[model samples]
Target: MNEDSLQHPKLERQPMEPRALKSIILSTITIVCAVTACIPLFSVLIMLLYRGGKRLTFQLFYTLPPGAFDAPGVGGFGHAILGTAFMVGIAGLISVPFGILAAIYLAELGPHHKVSEIARFCAKTMTGLPSIIAGVFAYAMVVLLMGHYSAWAGGIALSLLMIPTVMLTAEEAIKMVPNPMREAAYGMGCTPTQSLIKIILPVAMPSIITGVVLAVARAAGETAPLLFTALFSESWLAPNNPTASLAVLIYNWSSSPYQNLIELAWAASLILVVLVFFLNIISRAVGGKTKL
Candidate 1:
């Protein structure tokens, strides 16, 4: 062949492919969108820190809210902080086991079955369900049974909101484990249950933790559900008692006629935002450690 014909035609066309150009364009758009999304989030964080940082104090974590109309430095958010921790902890306890187990059933034990499909649909649906609806459900189910609002009831409401996210995340994580690993476990005389308990769960643990952290972050920032079920208290949160939460306190105090309480509210808002931010960071770290 002549020199001109001998050089591959594909080499000449490599730089001008329409498909490659399209992919570059699409990737650039995705990056721009992601950066754009982060702007509003960083703006919120800065705003909260500026508005609330002045009111944050050591006492904020150790003492109760002070007398009405007290100065900004006089009172703290101890009750709200404690209550938030307790209520969210209870919610975590209630949701994590059920969500993980259900995810295991769907992803590892019964993939492609009709019942699993139905359950997965229900979980995905719940993931989008309004937080207030979960609150209402908890109110009707738990509060009506007990005749009053309590921290446990608030937890039940939050668990409902948390469960769907956890289930979806865990299911996705479990699925990320390769089919070969499962087959190997089966090859080694492991029962399906034993394989799930040992091989699948251990492999998926990091991602599952990431999911739980994200779910808790979402639950922590919620207020509408707590409004209906938590029934905020200004005082200490007992286990079976209606209790204050940081979000609830922020909502109520932000509109106060007194500037000090308003400042306290701002501070609580900052704390809540920080906590959620921390959880997100942990989730990201754990997710990065996963091989996938």
Candidate 2:
């Protein structure tokens, strides 16, 4: 063929066909949908910063909630802050080990076995359940038994919410390890157990840590579960006592008629959002350092 004919092949300057045009349209739609989905998140962050940023003060960090409506005082949510930490700590204690072990079993031992399949199915199913259902489960199992709401009940409810998240994330992390890495360890006479403990787990640690942190973040902001399990306490109390939380405090104060309480709720919401943001940052940092 002549150079001109070769340069002007049948497809050279042809427009995209109907099928390709439709695909391009669909892809644009997908992008638009994804961007649209983020609008609410952006709106919330903006609203929280605007409403809450102005209300923050040193006293907001150290003081307790206001006293009775008749003799209201300038105070903050120190009790709720401490209560949130206490319950989340308890949740971490319960969920972290159990989740890691379950992930190990699923990824390192019998990923395709019947029992593993059953476990994975359950985890997936549990992940779909509402936070309120977890609260109800904890209420029936712990509150009914104890005859009252307590931080323990709240912790358990949060743990239930954390487990499936950690499990699925950790399992996928472990599975991401190369098959050749295990083979190399085996060639060096490492037992499966040793290889798993020394190689696989270390390799997977960053992702596992990230997963656990994310789960903890999710647990930290849960309100419905704490409402059913902790029932809210404004007074300073032990972990065994009914506890207040940032989420529940926000929920309560947001609905209150008092302007000050509403302001406090806004502040608490900002703090919670900041805390979750930091946790994510820490996770990314940890994950990055491990890979490096």
What's the TM for model 2? Answer: 0.87
**199: Cα error in model 1, Å:** 1.0
Clashing pairs in 2: none
Give each model a TM-score.
0.88, 0.87
Per-residue alpha-carbon lDDT of candidate 2 for residues 44-84, written as tens digits (9 for 90 to 100)? 99999999998888787777788647343378998899899
Q: All models: lDDT?
A: 0.90, 0.90
- Candidate 2: residue 219 lDDT (0-100): 93
**Mind giving the per-residue lDDT tens digits that candidate 1 earns over 172-286?**
9999999899999999999988998889898899999999999999999999888988888878878687899998998898898888888888899998888988999999999
Model 2: CA > 4 A from native? 1-35, 68-73, 288-292
Enumerate clash totals for all models, in the order shown.
0, 0
